[model samples]
Target: MRSLIRQGADVNAGDVGGFTPLHDAAREGHTEIVKLLLDAGADPNAVATEAGDQTPLLDAIGSGSIETVKVLLARGADVRGNDDAGWLPIHEAASRGTPEMVVALLEAGADVNARDAGNETPLHHAVARGTSQAGSVQIVRLLLDAGAELNAVDYQNRTPLHAAVATIDPSAELMRLLLQAGANPEAVDRHGHTVQDLARMNDNKMAPAMLTRALATARRDTGRSR
Candidate 1:
């Protein structure tokens, strides 16, 4: 490592997969080694062309180490680096359902509302999680707080609310959270389905009650303004 750097090892040299030393270290969560390579003139933004232009920062994220992710950001790893799927690191973090990882990327100015190849935002990814992870709800809240477009539709014209409603065993907490954030209950998807429509279609027994309550609240609020 240090000896090789001192001996003029090619820090940025890529293997057949275009993976540099920085990519390897970051992927393995070897935080110190990442720093050492970066200091030795490793290109933090070097792309693994054979691997969908995957950067070291992307690997750091896949490694699931906030420390390694932070080190990459500190060394000038571009948060906006494009991968094969048109996903930013934020998209990956959001789907992985780690609130802290999303927070780190958000703090580094990752686009909370940025669309991926599927035209889905980080919010879409968070809500589309079929099975809830530990911080899934918090991830949704974080994106909302960061100004994620709650109603932003994807290629399927499905908003985050739409996606949440269609999830198998959708969380009541998530349903309430989105409605509280002012998500439109009547918003339609590509198939012209509303939240209730999707709920019924999916046999989601939970979302209907919450959606009804939200609609009633919206009516009450509307009446007051009148």
Candidate 2:
């Protein structure tokens, strides 16, 4: 690989997924291969046509490959690029609950509040997944600490709180966290339903009540934090 790169092989060549060699290495979690590609001038921000317009950094984030994420970011990867999937690297990281990737991207100058074509921020995606399998809560907390807007709405006017109830296990603790962080449950979506209303209809009993509490807390916090 080093020899090929030195011989002028395209370091940024893509395969069927629009994945560059860097993307491939990152997807495979090959830190050494990634280092080799980067040292050879592979464009960290290069998007392959086969990879659905996703950059190496975004691919790494989707796979939750923190080591590869670090390598790409260190090489000046654009963490904010929205691919055909309508997801930024931070969004992918948050969706997968890759807290390390989330923190790293933010620290590397990725916009925590950056919205995709759908106007969904990292925080919006983070709180949407109610499952405990990935680090959803951790991702949400990290976004909050990084000054993510708890009340930021998507194209549908759904807040992060609106998303938290859609996942499995319906993280009550995460709902509490977003509430404490000032998410507005009373804010209605494009469908004219509040986050609390969505939760109530979701078949998950715990999350709706928690969302209601969050709405109340948001009101209280607004009164007191002033």
Candidate 3:
């Protein structure tokens, strides 16, 4: 690789897919190659056509290479750069439930509440793609603690709580977390369906029951506080 560079190889050359050497190195977790490519003046923010305009940093996050991500960030890669789909690196991290990547991106000033093309936040992805109930719960907690909007709505006017309850594998506990974080149980979607309505529509028995109880508790608390 060094010899090729010494011979004046175009470090930023892309194939038909628009994948630069840096994108390949970052996606493959080749830390040394990534450094060499960046040192050779490869554009760190180069987007791959086949990957929906994903940058090297986004690829590194997708590959779950923390060290490679560090390398890209050190080279001044755009942490907030999004793909053509409007999915940011933070959104990918959240979708994969990689807390380490999430923390790293956040530390580098990634917006926890950034919306995708669909207007869905990282919290929405975290809940929608979470592999398990406990995993989703942890990721949700992380986002909320980092100041994610508890009631942020997507293009469909569905909040994270709404998305959570409507997921193929719904978790009552996840809904509980959102409610506790001040998510509005009464909030409706574009179709006028509330969180409970979504849960029932999705055949999620536990979530609706949990949301109802939480809503009752929240109402009582509000009444008392007033």
Candidate 4:
């Protein structure tokens, strides 16, 4: 990269949508190329001229490249830089359920409470989409340990509990984890349906029963609080 930079290649130049070579290299996991570029004086936090919204840190987190993330952060990359969608690096890490990436971002000062444009926090993404449930659950536990807000709601007014229940018959472990993490089982969506209601609507008996149990626990907890 230094040789190329010495040859007058614009290290900071990005393609359309602001993707520079550094971004591509980071996404592609080219650690050597990334090191070369950084050593050659590439702007660690360079926002693409066309993509001027994200820093290399964002790309690193999105790609779950802990080495790249460390390199960028060591070179003074801004961990909290927002992309076009207002997603911070932590959000990217959480979405992918990359606990290593999440830890790196947190160590580098990524905001634990940062929300996207949709008002969805990292916890919301962790419990969504069924395929990532295990990873998401692990990520959620980490975030909760780090003090992520449990009662956060999304644009659709769905909480993390709502997302978990939307999955078809989620495991008892997952249900228990979310509840233990403080997910509100009674959280209502924009349509005014509780997670229990949605579970019943889908004929997912196990999920509704789980959510209902959570609700019962919460009610008892609330009564004690009063």
- Give the best candidate by TM-score: 3
- How accurate locally is residue 15 in candidate 4, as Cα lDDT from 0 to 100? 79
TM-score of 2: 0.86
Clashing pairs in 3: none
The digit string of per-residue lDDT tens for model 4 on 122-223 reads: 777666644433366567778888888877888888887777777664544555667765677667889999876777775556776766676666656667
Per-residue error for 81 in candidate 4, Å, reads 0.9
Candidates 3 and 4 compared by TM-score, better number: 3
Model 1: residues >4 Å from true position, as ranges?
A: 203-226
lDDT of 1: 0.85
* Model 3 agreement with the true structure over 35-95: per-residue lDDT tens digits: 9999899999998877589799988987778888888888898977999989998898888
TM-score of 3: 0.87
Better of 1 and 3 by lDDT: 1
Q: Against the true structure, candidate 4 has what lDDT? A: 0.74
Clash pairs of candidate 4?
Answer: 18-51
Write one digit per residue (lDDT tens) for candidate 2, span 74-151. 888887677886788888887773778888888888888988888989877776666556677778888899899888
lDDT, residue 51, candidate 3 = 59
